[model samples]
Target: MARDTGPGLARGSTARGRGATRSPGWALAVILTLICVVAGLVPGRPGTVALAVPFALLALSGRDHRTGARSGTEPLVLISTDRHLTRSTSTLRLLLTPRPKEEPTKTLAAPSLVAITLAAPGCPADGLVLQADEECPLVADIPVSGEIAVLSYGSAGVSADVVRPTDFVQAPPVRVSVLPQVGPTLARPVSRRLSGLSGSHTSRRPGEGGELRSIAPMQPGDQQRRIDWRATARRSTDQDMLMVRRTFADAEASVVLVVDRANDLPASTEDWFAAGTSTLGQGSLHVARTAAATVAASYLAAGDRVGLDDLSGTRRPLRSAAGSRQLEQIRTRLAGMSVVPRRRHRRDPVPPQGAVVIIFSAFLDEEPARLLRLWHAQGHPVIGVDCVPVLQRTESSRAQDQTVRLTLLRRRLLLEDLQTEGITVLSGSVQDEPGRQSEREHGAPLPDAAGTDLDTGLRLLARQSRRGAGLSAAPGTARGIR
Candidate 1:
């Protein structure tokens, strides 16, 4: 987070009537000149010099007036220790006032304010949590102080005590919410199916054998000794009864969602073609967030662990695990991720084994392909979600030619390549329905195949019991499992 700390003047030239007014001194000079001419004191060199004196003074006054007007309108920024300023010492303050208001006895409060506070080393950093008193206008300060930053929402009064001469770090507040439509699908299984599996069996009786039901007559191959003699004698018929064994698929699975944040796409039509065909959405980080959230929620509801690996900055991978608590941790990590440029690493770290590797990235280059290959080779199910349509068409260009065709072609190539490498590829535009392209592409028969590869792909996906598998593997092309 970077704060703007330079001079506060608005850029570009000011329009007429929008700038400082003419100085009062100029008016006074005109009045004095009138008086001098009317008095007729020699009306020669002395009169000329006398008139010039007032004009000279007016010119200086005009300059000062302009300077004062500019300064007075500037914002007065204050970084406070707390919202109420009850305690705490570390603070900074800067005052800016408009030139026109310099002469007036007026107090200026900033219409908008931004503040950032950094925690001292070893202090417990809580991150950017905002709290405000009932009387306060806006309480946008984040309490986590490792390198805390805050900005006023829209145009709001800002006051704080932490203004230093140096620049301060600022970060946007973390926003977390279940995607309304997909949330229920991700959450239902966790609370219902998983909970039932963990609970004790419901068939137990109240008293006998510590709530265990009475055993009936033994059948062939049944263990003979444990059969309740009294119950079997009463029945007078052959039967077999034993404790039912419950299977819990509620065991959690861990998934590592790898997102590539590197911006390496070209700037021309070729670049657009390249992006249009990739699995990840044109390598845009925002698309990555959406896809990651969707996948993370799905696995989380299944009682499967989820972790994040930001392919930006340092590749300090967030490990995966499932539980209500671990899910919260994953959400927090995802919320805090910031998109950054790619780093240069001659040697990339190997992805961890046994975890489902769901990579959300635009497969613009060979790097992501290599990573997916490595994960698949290690016996982990690797699913690559392609996010196409990085650019939005305007109303005027709604009927643009060739753009849509080229986009589809590139996407198809990308998906085919990935499929050949054994990585499951899913592709689709963010604005369209989720599974349309996957169904279409997977439904079509492969060239020279006896039946459609689409059917075989569906069977493979059905066997896995997870949606969004078995599609052509290429960059920038098709929409797969969402």
Candidate 2:
């Protein structure tokens, strides 16, 4: 994006200044001349008055011709990037356009030096490389990390001996959002009530598809192309009996990612009550966005429809659709989600019939649980992803530690209740500790001591679906919860 920072004249003023305002050198010259004249009158030094003449000439020569000239036009900075992947190196192209003068004689000369500053979480001070030009728009490729990058420009310095006074205007800073990196491809959560459109997953009903169902006696309406010659030869049936092959219909599944943006907490319990705590690299919202994006990409790649819904906002839900564009839309919405407090709790969004509903939330309260039960009752395969960051016990008082324990206990109980109701629960939380290098590098969950990660949790969810036959099972009847 290109932007005109602002309009202002900030001239260089020093002892050598001229025009209406006399320079400090001129004042000093006048003061010394008066002292010399006083000395000549008192000590009979006749030539002292002549010594003041050189000082007067020195002040007269320090003249400024462009006192009323305007400041140089502000340079426009344009920022463009090819991709926005998290936990990875991405290049930011910065195009610097030189200031344009509306009137050549009215404006001051261009800035002599330019300074570029790049700011982001954990960004180095010497990250920016400057190569500015007076005519052409200078382009510099900046490597950035983390979620957000802020680029700013300003005047480094200016020469005082120029014919006309000049000031370099600082460009307005530009902020670019780096999207969270997507994890490994996941098994698209199959919905029991698949849509009629042809897709990767096999439907329960027999149709012209890939997966084999069964071979049966051919009916009058059965297509001749579907005749199973091998099955007909194997079966010792009546004369002229023919067999036909049957297969399940190919159908697509709709996945709606319901994200809760009410609370964004850090991993450590110590920072919970502190204001302006740095959640760099470790935040609940970060995990939720990453998980949502990864799941959306995997499902869309498998020819499934994916949609997004924000629980804490009042905007219209993104409808389910299939394509690369759908994934981009979901990622954009997820990247923009932030903690919005005091929001009126609206009615839960209803997903398409039989769509797998995955809700990402910290689940600090009962709101998310209530929605999970609601979708479960509606015969939708619901999965609740706990997005609360992993609890880190820091050097705090005993009371604070106890409070942390109690909060964790309460969350565990809530998740258990949801699981008991046949809603699959998965942990999408990540640790913020710097020691967890693997977690930081992968941007995905690492297996715990119990060998449970996001992939393991999802595999368990698939197993549960198979055991209960998702839609065929009665609501709240599947007791084998993991």
Candidate 3:
């Protein structure tokens, strides 16, 4: 398999082999030849022999043999996308370029046209119609977007002209991460104890900044820039003593978003206890990704360092950074995260020292709650984001209903206990609406309600941050469903 990753483009290709059945045209020719032979057996049909000869020739014309591919090289089918990262939609193109042997022999020829069927979670089932053109590579535009799109080759059309040594070499799945559409710019939860020299948030200490901290008599080492001439004149009649303006210094905060990818429960309550057959975009993992992206973007926009961490321990944690590129990296990483069941315990993530930690999870397990207490103990302003979507009750078995009720009760108690420990709880639940089905099917942006709830939760957290009490400021803070 061949893979290419260029700027803004993702490409993967399949290697060719030999072992294909006769093509439809060959089957038709063979049937015709057999019919002609049978008809020629009739004493009255003398012209059938002539017809049988032509049909037999046609049937043998496209006989399969050693593939036309060179001994060392195989014909390739490549799939490319205009962009690997898309918020809504992108165009994917497939190209089939056949490499024939240099020395021609009695071997089979390369396929003139290659038909391919692609399968994805939310894509068409029918095989794509490809127009064969020897001069140009086959082109078929595939529209891919929404939540996450993983494309893989399904089946290829069989032809007698081409033979393979083995099955087609399957190319790796091409993953396109569609970053979530966020709502209005959110009020990022700033750390109470900020760091770094320069940022958007105002620090408690006085230095060079826009927001005035206090005004007092000019002291030694106070530059002329810090001196308030107006205040000096008003306070000192003869201008003997000068008054200087002191402003709070600007500092940046480090925020690490821990995303749990263990379970992805859907919003429909009835589907909670069922197998993992929930719709692709309508699950806890989607909500978690969306919330993490939204929060990371907001904080990054505020000149804060934001990082990403997966709780399932499937990948390394991204270091905190403040930039547009960092934001892109975080979103891409979030979009690529999938449910990875943890069979054994893994080491907890170690974020930057004194960094604020925000976790996005369904809170169905004790891991998130334990982490919340651990971060709080470490003096990091911790916020727990419940990514479980709004549940809608439906008719179900009594046992399943009891199980759901018991699970919810346990989750609620866990959250309440965390809140008692001064951990601010936030909701990132995606609401299940009537119009969401169309949006999911059509690759539209996610509902803004989820972002709105997150925004509100962070706003309250921000308010708490300003009051010198970050997580402890909001005890028992719960929003969304139960």
- Per TM-score, the best of the predicted structures is 3
Q: What are the lDDT scores of the predictions, listed in order?
A: 0.42, 0.64, 0.64
lDDT of 3 by residue, 305-395 (tens): 9988878887778989999999888877876776788545556667677688889988888998888888788778788888877655542
Which 10 successive residues of model 1 have the least lDDT summed?
A: 187-196
Instruction: List model 2 lDDT by residue over 398-434, tens digit each.
Output: 8876676677667777877876876777877543356
lDDT of 2: 0.64
Model 1 over residues 38-69: C-alpha lDDT tens digits?
55555565655566565555544333232223
- Could you give me the TM-score of model 1 versus the true structure? 0.45
**Each candidate structure's count of clashing pairs:** 57, 0, 7
Off by over 4 Å in 2: 1-103, 107-149, 152-170, 236-238, 268-280, 391-409, 430-452, 470-482
TM-score of each: 0.45, 0.68, 0.69
**Ten contiguous residues minimizing lDDT sum, candidate 2:** 473-482
RMSD of each: 15.5, 9.3, 10.2
Residue 173 lDDT in model 2?
A: 62
| Candidate 3 worst ten-residue window by lDDT | 473-482
